[model samples]
Target: MFPSSRLRRQRKAISFPAGWQIIPIAGKYWTSGAADGLGGWRWTGNLEANFDDFTKWGVGQPDSDMVKQRVALNFQSLAAVFWESEDDTMSMRYICEVEDSGTPTSPQPTVTTTTPTTTTPTTTPPPVNECNARKALFIVLESSSHVGSANFQLGKQFAADLSRAFTGLSTSKLGFLTYALIYHVRVHLHNSDSPEEIVSDILSAAYEGHSTRNTAEGMLAAKLQLETYSSGNPMHMVVLTNGVSASPSTTKHIADLANLVGIRTYAIGVSMPDSADQELLNIAGQYSDRVFKTDWARLDTILGSVVNKVCNS
Candidate 1:
């Protein structure tokens, strides 16, 4: 659903079949909760998009009070306006244009197989143990406009999968919440539920808000929760975000503080590689092995990595 500005402009110039009156535009303008940086009528979103070129806007359009909405083009008016729906999703007919409109090429995993020579008998080394089963895990998710309803729900499912993966492990505990302008406790700390119960709670969690993201506040809140239930276990956190945080300085400070306190963090930056925040590496600490980034649509694929690293680091 996330298209680029160049593609949107192309669609605007192209001809569509009948009944395709409304189309979702490339960028999203997040002005829902509070006026963070939305300068009245000025557009602000998707740094890669050409929002500065505003020749396609409707007359006095984009005046919506909501902050977490995206843009849609009106074929009849030849203008673009903010689109919203009752289910918090794009309800209009959409144009699906393939970026690579040819035969697709997917990456294949490389495999290496070698036959062992019987010249000398070698003893196999003992399997190295990396699992830190008794770790307390906290996952802080972003529920801002940066992550729309679809992706936000997908994120919850991703968390649920990760939490469930740790189930049956001797000493794994999971705590989770969403942080926008403020954080909400979807699943509280010290919840002595089985792994299955924790996963159920996460899967059923709802989006708290579409406000601006407060990453620092989320990290701080997670730190407090982890402290309460840590019980001397190795602590870990998986924080997922789709955009730059509302408080970068504060987030960095708190991340540093958490690191000093022996809390290992796994930063999951979900967005296009170029658009995603590179600060995630810093947040994940010196071990780059724990940092991860993925397109918003592909966030679920990283759920396994998050669960494995947090539970077995």
Candidate 2:
């Protein structure tokens, strides 16, 4: 498998090894870094990897049975190199990327491969949650009229629930913001107060109830907040909404910018329409697992899952 954690929080790119097209097109080598997440296949590290691009997938690839075949590989040939579904247990070559700090202030990706070695098996430790690993999270709640009073309450509860979940994680930094016609930062990532404080702030804040859904503007504001109050940890953004923006393409453009800076974004939809779900998917880097959907009545059900992801992913 690929070194799953090396690019976990970095802005980097990965290209095929030089002359990779010559590699065996079949039964030769593939990478296991792409795995089946709860909802769909996801790259092990760096959500910014662009695995969501449909053009990168080979014909009939990823297969129909996403459950049993939990891993994916690359199929290389004279014509193309693309991804294909494979069994997780398969032995294969894996690719890894690292940042070349000497290149420039901007991130430059360089590939490095580790030769597989056989070693005596040992007890593998449990995965560390992101909260314990010093990660920063910013929650963006939609307060536009499109969300309505009922859904707005649910969004508040959702933020409050997350705050409670991350309250005692000493190393984690938390922030909260709301967007509609205007953007408001309820909490800063650098706030010395505990995450629990965010719960109160979120609940007490007034809803904007504006007609415009300035999702892109809110996202830009979030990027500024993270840059200004950076905890120097892996940063994540979660956007909760119940309606599509008037300009979803603008929101997607901002999302691409955020991803370029190593800010992984998750989109949660509350009883949103199909168009809004598509908008959320675009915001979530086109990954299904990163876009969670639920009605206001069942919003609480996904709170725990989102908390776990914020804590561990």
lDDT of 2 by residue, 1-313 (tens): 2333433434354344545553354543544234322234433333333344333556776576532233444544646656666543356665434444533343359999966533221133122222455667889999998888666876787777766655566777778889885466787677888554666677776778977787765776676566556668788889988778756776787788788888888999888877667899888877678889898888877876786776676
- Per-model TM against the reference: 0.56, 0.57
RMSD of 1: 14.5
Task: Provide the overall lDDT of each model, using Cα atoms, as 2-decimal numbers.
Answer: 0.61, 0.66
lDDT tens digits by residue: candidate 1, 216-293? 667766776676677787888889888777656657767877888889988888873654445686567646788888
| Regions of candidate 1 where Cα sits further than 4 Å from its true position | 1-132, 272-276
* lDDT, residue 23, candidate 2: 36
Worst 10 residues of 2 by lDDT: 119-128
Clashing pairs in 2: 130-311
